[model samples]
Target chain A: MSRLSKKERQKLLKQVIKDNPFLTDKELADKFEVSIQTIRLDRLELGIPEVRERTKTVAQNAYARLRSVNEGEVIGELTKLKLDNYAESYLTTTREMALQKTPIIRGHHIFAQANSLAVAVIDAEKVVTGSAEIKFTRPVMVGDVIKARAEVKEIKGKKYFVEIKIYKDSDLVFYGDFTMFKLENGGV
Target chain B: MSRLSKKERQKLLKQVIKDNPFLTDKELADKFEVSIQTIRLDRLELGIPEVRERTKTVAQNAYARLRSVNEGEVIGELTKLKLDNYAESYLTTTREMALQKTPIIRGHHIFAQANSLAVAVIDAEKVVTGSAEIKFTRPVMVGDVIKARAEVKEIKGKKYFVEIKIYKDSDLVFYGDFTMFKLENGGV
Candidate 1:
């Protein structure tokens, strides 16, 4: 490892990070058998952001591409979205969402989260749901943290087909396929 | 008009009421140039129910064919439902449904009503929303009386495609296209 030149180590560092984006600077330093300062310098020279910044960039890019729904209108905290591509969100069910006499969250609450994500993924001036098919494999309960992922499957004219899956921990809880229609920005 | 026989008048009355179910007994009596009592007697002889009963029957038939959702679980007052055909529901937004600092009802409430109507129209032991495309054409305010209608547009195997429209005072306020999945009665 000591025989490796600075240029060679920087190249390897870049590849390792691309493979595993969560690694810390200290970990990279240890793997490269170099001092932490050297790793930091290499990262700065290569214009590579820190892990936190890297993660934030993905999320920011997603939000920036959103056009249909406002940030507050999104049912859950949208974690990431790429226009006409893929998106992610996180929702923690509240006590008020519980069904009568049960801890299970109301079905509509789940649908709202998934539906909003589908609309947000469309890169358009406005979007409409043309239709959807959905299923719930398990009940989500109050206080359960759910994660949702959406992917655009196809686009035909002004229509977009999106698929969304929601999970609680590792369990698949809900699924939805949305057909969205993109509308012109203004009537004029 | 007096020269017309009773049978001839009753036959015309039947056809007229069929064309316009909302006409009252008084209106019919005036139109037929007969007393209200005579129209009532004629309706009884013809096995035609009162207008209120006629409307109630349509609503009752709709609610009766519902198997996928319990009446209480429905988001709005399910007025009429015919399994695998068409259905109607009415929802009046309450004060609690109003958004913060605005009298407008939240978008999710409108979606809940449409989604529940979609699920309730499926004549299955159990039903799941496979996906939907939806739009809020106008903001629904608190105390707004909204009417929703759903029709089964198509079906393929275990899937049902439904179209739903909502109106507030004859203005189209919302729309949804839903794809629903029917699950078997028992996991056993």
Candidate 2:
């Protein structure tokens, strides 16, 4: 038979597991008449996060797992980095976080917090922002405790890019990038 | 009169308004000891917005002001823009916002809310994410409402670059962004 289309393969795979949540990859392979590897590939494409290590990710904060940083970690001081995620940074209004009277704390402070954490976790001491895009999905206000989690997504030559997500608790309030440049000294 | 350095001009301008809450253009000119035309030019160069009859922006919703949505005013309709003067936003948990959550709301819902708002306020209808640099600054759990804001700094042809900030009830939560793209008719 001609090779099945990607869409067709996915449809067939979904149908096989429509009744059960615990279908094994091998079982899926047997029913779909495909190799286990193909089934696994399909699962990945479908965004079905593997069930094997749910705790490693789901149990602990996704941010903590990505980096060595522990869950519920708080940054006490924003140290200096010659270059931040992007050559830019949020400087003012940071002190206003976690205050009362202001119905909403402010968005800039959140952005700064994200940027600061990204810079702190860098492997290179001097890194700059090459380019980035971010989506602001919610309102952050004063007194809200913010925790930043970041991961190194890719390392290409001298350029390193990381993905960071900010959560007030379970809600992902912010998401963006931290672009860092590796210094010639090899210190991050 | 000799031209002033950037620093000197800034200091002089500050001295003029040392105690006043506001300064008129003519008043600014006299204080700076420069022509009205010079003061006007300085204001533009410094990115100072002119105060007028103080027409409220069409969209007054937290997102609209932060993103700077552009459209005819529609009373009672919240602004969709996502940036404000201070790159700020306010936040309260769903329990606090006292608003019902929709199905579209998810881990990425808050992020998408602010991102989409930012995109909607862009001068063009067509837009795409060029890249994103982010960090998850705080834990946004259920019941926490976040306020977010972003600013546009650089504009290159179809590209509208920006910086953003987020907060949760007077607390600084998230911030960042160095670039964005304004598509030509939705074509990449």
Best by DockQ: 1
Model 2 lDDT, residue B158, Cα = 73
Interface RMSD of 2: 14.4
A1-188 per-residue lDDT for model 1 (tens digits):
56578889989989877644545788778778888899889999999999778656655665676677665677877778778898888787998775344566767899889878987888876666666667777878788778899999998878789999998867999887777777664211
Predictions in order: lDDT: 0.77, 0.47
The segments of candidate 2 whose C-alpha lies over 4 angstroms from its true place after superposition are A1-95, A98-102, B1-188
Per-candidate clash tally:
17, 96
DockQ of each: 0.15, 0.07
| Cα deviation of B131, candidate 1, in Å | 8.1
Top candidate by TM-score? 1
- The TM-score obtained by model 1 is 0.49
Candidate 2, residues B1-188, lDDT tens digits: the string is 35788668866665543323134677677756778887767767765544221113322443343222233211112323432222333323453211122211122334443444445445554444444444435445555546566677767787766665555545655554645565453322
How far off is each candidate at the interface, as Cα RMSD in Å?
Answer: 5.5, 14.4
Docking class of 2: incorrect
True contacts kept of each: 0.27, 0.12
